[model samples]
Target: MREHPNVIAVQDALDAAGAHTADDAPSLVVILDEGAHTAAAAAEALCIEVGQIANSLIFDADGEPLLVLTSGAHRVDTAKVAAALGITKLRRATPEFVRTHTGQAIGGVAPLGHPKPVRTLVDTALAGFRDVWAAGGVPQAVFPITYAELVRVTDGTPTDVA
Candidate 1:
């Protein structure tokens, strides 16, 4: 089946960023019948540990959109993140806010391909896994990438999110 347009956009973004998946272990985009909207669902579908899933989350930090690529194993500690960023508050972005910022729905927000650059924070915890799976701008589509590559591609700041 042909890939979704949103997924193609993500693939194009990765390519433009020179973030190719490893040639030896080519990372193909997988499409699932059931949406891998949640990190748990994605991990189960990909047959990997939950922690190997990178959950793309958007938050409203001091009225700006902030992207947090957190691990599936734990929840983000908003307080810690806010304090670390020297922000007064960090609240979860609503569906409308997510779509507006990411140009993608909540469940399939990728680290890249936003209409404009969004400040990103990648979880240091994801470094524990050699490879991690992330959304591909569509809930049913997913792709594999290394934690380091993810950080480089997104130009994300590495920090502890949990």
Candidate 2:
């Protein structure tokens, strides 16, 4: 398969994180819809429900990157999240801020293997699914992960994102 630079970077990060094995490398499918920028769009392209799509939202917490993997069907309640995290405030990150911290673009951020571990939160709603998919470092690439594995891989705390 052809490899994009971003995809390569994702592979490197996955390797570093000791995620899935080479024998079980996740498939990254590039869909025709570039508009798959949102979870609802992605789910439509993949023929899945919006809830099945995981939105890798970035929050700016005192200039630090805070990652939230939320289900598409719900909106993240930032105030609640901040309260849960014991942070006084949380703001949506800008595109530049996202790339600076995640080394991946907004529509294609993955859960783990960032240059540094962004303080992460996995949506409790995701636990409803047996499997979940995340961006594989590129907009077109994605991989499957279970809710349990998502927490294990990201070392993220479980909380209500919506």
Candidate 3:
């Protein structure tokens, strides 16, 4: 199979987000793996612990896009996250909803390539890794980024979302 167009879009977004500048580039290694559609698959492909993979989960908060970049080893408790956001509810977004908001499919949402800045929350657990990997707008692609750099590129706030 060839590289998906969405992957190219992600590279462009990364460049536009200043994630691709030669000096500021955070050693993000975008790997293409046919089997890497989930965090487990990606970890296996990269030979890294699942916890080191940052899973970009999308949630809908009364129609608003809520992007939560959480650790692959942890499942986010929606109740706690909703309370953190002081919202009445939080639900997992459907694939279509996720695409509508982030312009990327589930399992392949890039941390910084959404059509707009969704209210983003970065899991505190991600800070444990000096380097982390996240999807690059396609299921078969991923890139390396640091916790601080991810936060900066996504305009996300670090919080205990896990």
Measured against the true structure, the TM-scores of the candidates, in listed sequence, are 0.93, 0.85, 0.90
Q: Which stretches of candidate 3 lie over 4 Å from their true place?
A: 1-3, 20-29
**Highest lDDT, which number?**
1
- lDDT (C-alpha) at residue 50 in model 3: 99
Model 1 lDDT tens row, 40-153: 899999899999999999999988999999999999999999999999979999999999988999888888878889999999999998888889888888888888889998
- Candidate rank order under TM-score: 1, 3, 2
lDDT of 2 by residue, 1-162 (tens): 227666676666555555642245543334344546778777877777788777889999877889999998999998988887778779999999998888888888877657788889999998887667777776777766667767877889998878
Worst 10 residues of 2 by lDDT: 21-30
Off by over 4 Å in 1: 22-27
Candidate 1 all-Cα RMSD: 1.6
Candidate closer to the true structure by lDDT (higher is better), 2 or 3: 3
C-alpha lDDT (0 to 100) for residue 121 of candidate 3? 93
User: Which digits, one per residue and each the tens of the lDDT, describe model 3 over residues 1-24?
Assistant: 126666776676666666632245
Write the candidate numbers in order of decreasing lDDT: 1, 3, 2
Model 1 steric clash pairs: none
